[model samples]
Target: MYVIYLRKSRKDSDLEALGIDVLKRHEETLLELARARSLPIGAIYREVVSGDSIDARPEMVRLLSEVESGIWEGVLVMEVERLARGDTIDQGRVQRAFFYSNTLIVTPGKTYNPAIENDNEYFEFSLFMSRREYATIKRRMQAGRIRSVKDGYYVGNIAPYGWRRVKADDCKHFTLVPDEKENPVLKLMYDFMGNKKYGFQKTCSALTGMGIVSRSGKPFNPATVKTIISNPVNIGMLRWNYRKSQKAIVNGKIATSRPKADDYILAKGKHPGCISEDLYYRANSVNSSMTAPVKRSCRIQNPFAGIVRCSCCGRVMVRKKMSAKQPRDYLICQYAGCATVAIELDELENAVLEWIRNYIADYKVNNFESADDSEQESLRSILVNLEKEKETTLKQRGSLFDLLEQGIYTKEIFFERSTALEDKIKDFDKKIESVNADIVRLDLSKKNRSTFVPKCQELLNAWDTFDAADKNTALKNVIERIDFTKTEKNARGQRHSSFSIDVFPRISR
Candidate 1:
């Protein structure tokens, strides 16, 4: 039996320009090739995923797994490169799987039997050539994008909300044009922030009430409103490279990170301003001033400043000094005419800490009978698999060096292959470390009540020694909010208050 595999690479601009019809033609071509070769097609695997990496393609992974079962005599594709154009590890995996299964790779150009030494080398060379081609194309595209950015043209597909894109006279670059509908909403947002002094939530609510939707055609959220207000594009300026971004595939999804601020290029864009520069600055300045911390000479740090909320008005409680002589702080509700009682900082901290200590003690007692043994077992299994993968990668690296020494591989190919394998080994090492950490955490969780009790006690002791910042972090981690009611004076003239504390422990119950 044989399987026919078809893949469409999004990086091929020519193929994309031809539309969905081209994909049908590609499949027909492969099918005709298989029919002419008298190969039996058991199944067909097709996907439209970019890049050569198997991580991005579910069908490729299924095909490789099926091939490994030795159920298929071979896989038929248009060309050898269709199997893989990824890094060395993926290329090696495909080759080795076919070699071990004694399957042939059938292409219109030739049939490659991985068990044959010459055929195996030819297949590897094809994959290497494909990888080089992919790298070159990627580099060219990235260079073009950077050049476009430097030329004051929009390189991205979608323009910011409230803007439309029009091709420049060159027909290769894009310029932003104001969207008559969204641009008015954008100006209204600036007006709300600067002139009306409406905060993000209030502005979002007002926009939603006015039936103004975001780019997704959904009611405007605070985040969407804030992005429009904060963006510099509204002022007819283009800002690029404000932050350095790195992309990685995590659990089959592309995750991006902007680690730190980098050098930024700001240029006047070829677009009319939706809002004046003065309005933009004024709006942002007002937002910053409203959010600034209360001034103090000694910089008094209150752990529960923002977390505490009024039980009556459900508004955030603000920190205020009780008296100049007392030197004590209290969290008071800022809502007008709210009778919610003020909470002394010391009293609130003591009450929260005591509750946490008791909660941890009770959790330890209750969970002592039910350990996370299943999680530990799962971690052990993952660690074993990771170790095996690491060993296989190391062996492959050593084999590559042997091939280099035997003059079977040129220095350039040898270095490229070795570097790729080293990267795989590094990724495996990271996974192993992460698994080990999980196992350790599970082990601690499964410890006896006596052992667990001491850990909780140590945590309590650590709180006493923590600085104001650390204390604040600890409070935020364990307690969600502390609500207070008005204090009452007893017949004996003693003041008493009640609190409703919302505790959210870090550990699961």
Candidate 2:
């Protein structure tokens, strides 16, 4: 049976702009080709994914997996280029899948049988040309977007909260227009910040009090308020590349992210702004002058800053101050959907200290130590030998140059000898690195076993004398994390309530 695959080509931007269904058209053409050839169609894989890598395209990945599993006799497409236009690795993967499975690639103009050498070579050549064409198309698209931005038009997919996009007079592009109901609300937000001297939380309160919400139809958050107040678009300036695209291989997979850029284009836009320049700048200046409450005068307050986790949800619980009527600090879960409950700050600290006290008592009873010095010494010995071998290899590599200069070795011979020695040196370095890591892990184990007890004892003895910041540092050195849970309840007047604290010490619990 034959399967049909359809993916929109980058070359079909003209068709897309003209509101033509390129994928549907390609499918119809392939179905007609199947009928002409008297082929039986088992399945159709229509790919709408707009990405370069096979890893990014789900339908292509599924198709490749099925083809590699030897399920179909042939695959039909408009062209081979539609199967793979990604990087060389993806192209080779697509080629090998069909070649090994003996699957036929049936296109309208030609049919490629991967078993034949001539057909295989022709298939490779076609893929090479397709790759070149794809690269050109990508460059042209980027240039078009840059030109659109420079022409003072709105090119982003979605407009900001207080604006709407309308087709320009030429009907080729879009321009921003102020929204009737939202524009006045945006202006009012600026007025509250600029003239009325309100902070983010107070502004959020003011908006919610007036029954005005965000674009998500929810109460305004401080981060969203900051975005609105800081954007240059409110003052009729179009900004581009505020966050630049960056890609890196993380854990052997390509990861892409957009980070804030220092330099960006802020140009005069074609549409009028909802707020005046005076109000925009004034609000920004006022917002900038105030310090955020979370900074806490550059001092640490939570001793379990990075060491506390909610057992139910695994989220880091934060310490928050209650209202003026209550006037007490409480450790609370961040989200309302979480199953965990809040506890008073003082009570939580007491429970943690008690857990540590019990841990120290248990450690004293065990009183054991790790004797890893001999293994560490053995690893160091191996490292020393590896370094000596690497130095000898480097010296050998250097002598090849002399051999070539003296006409004793031909250029090819010298290159071969030099490459061999370079590879040997690289191997030695890799061994040295592995041995070094082993030695370091041994040392850390010894330190955790021999040194952690005394430190834990000192922390308990001097707990009262240390300040909050010092105590936090001391606690971090001994504790990895504390998993807290409070699924049971007790009387309100009870001091030691029905709660559990599972301490994960760096050494032992």
In order of appearance, the predictions have TM-scores of 0.61, 0.63
Instruction: List candidate 2 stretches off by more than 4 Å.
Output: 286-509
What is candidate 1's lDDT per residue for 1-509, written digit by digit as tens? 89988876545567667665655777788789878878888998887776547767899899999899998999888778878888888889888889899988887788899888999999889989988988898789878877777777876688888888999888878989888887888889999988888876567667777877777776675556666788788998877766657788889766777753556767777676789888898877654212235454544366775677777777676665556654677766643335566666777778877877787767767664355766688889989999998999899988997898899999999989988998999999999999999888767555544354464566588987877666776666555566655544224434344666765444444
Model 2 steric clash total: 0
Task: Give lDDT tens digits, candidate 2, residues 59-110.
Answer: 8899899999999999999999888888888899999999999999999999
Whole-model Cα lDDT per candidate? 0.75, 0.82
Clashing pairs in 2: none
Q: Which candidate leads in TM-score?
A: 2
Ten-residue region with minimum lDDT total, candidate 2: 287-296
Question: In every candidate, how many clashes are there?
Answer: 0, 0
RMSD of 1: 16.0
RMSD of each: 16.0, 16.9
Least accurate 10 contiguous residues by lDDT in model 1 = 287-296
lDDT of candidate model 1 versus the reference: 0.75
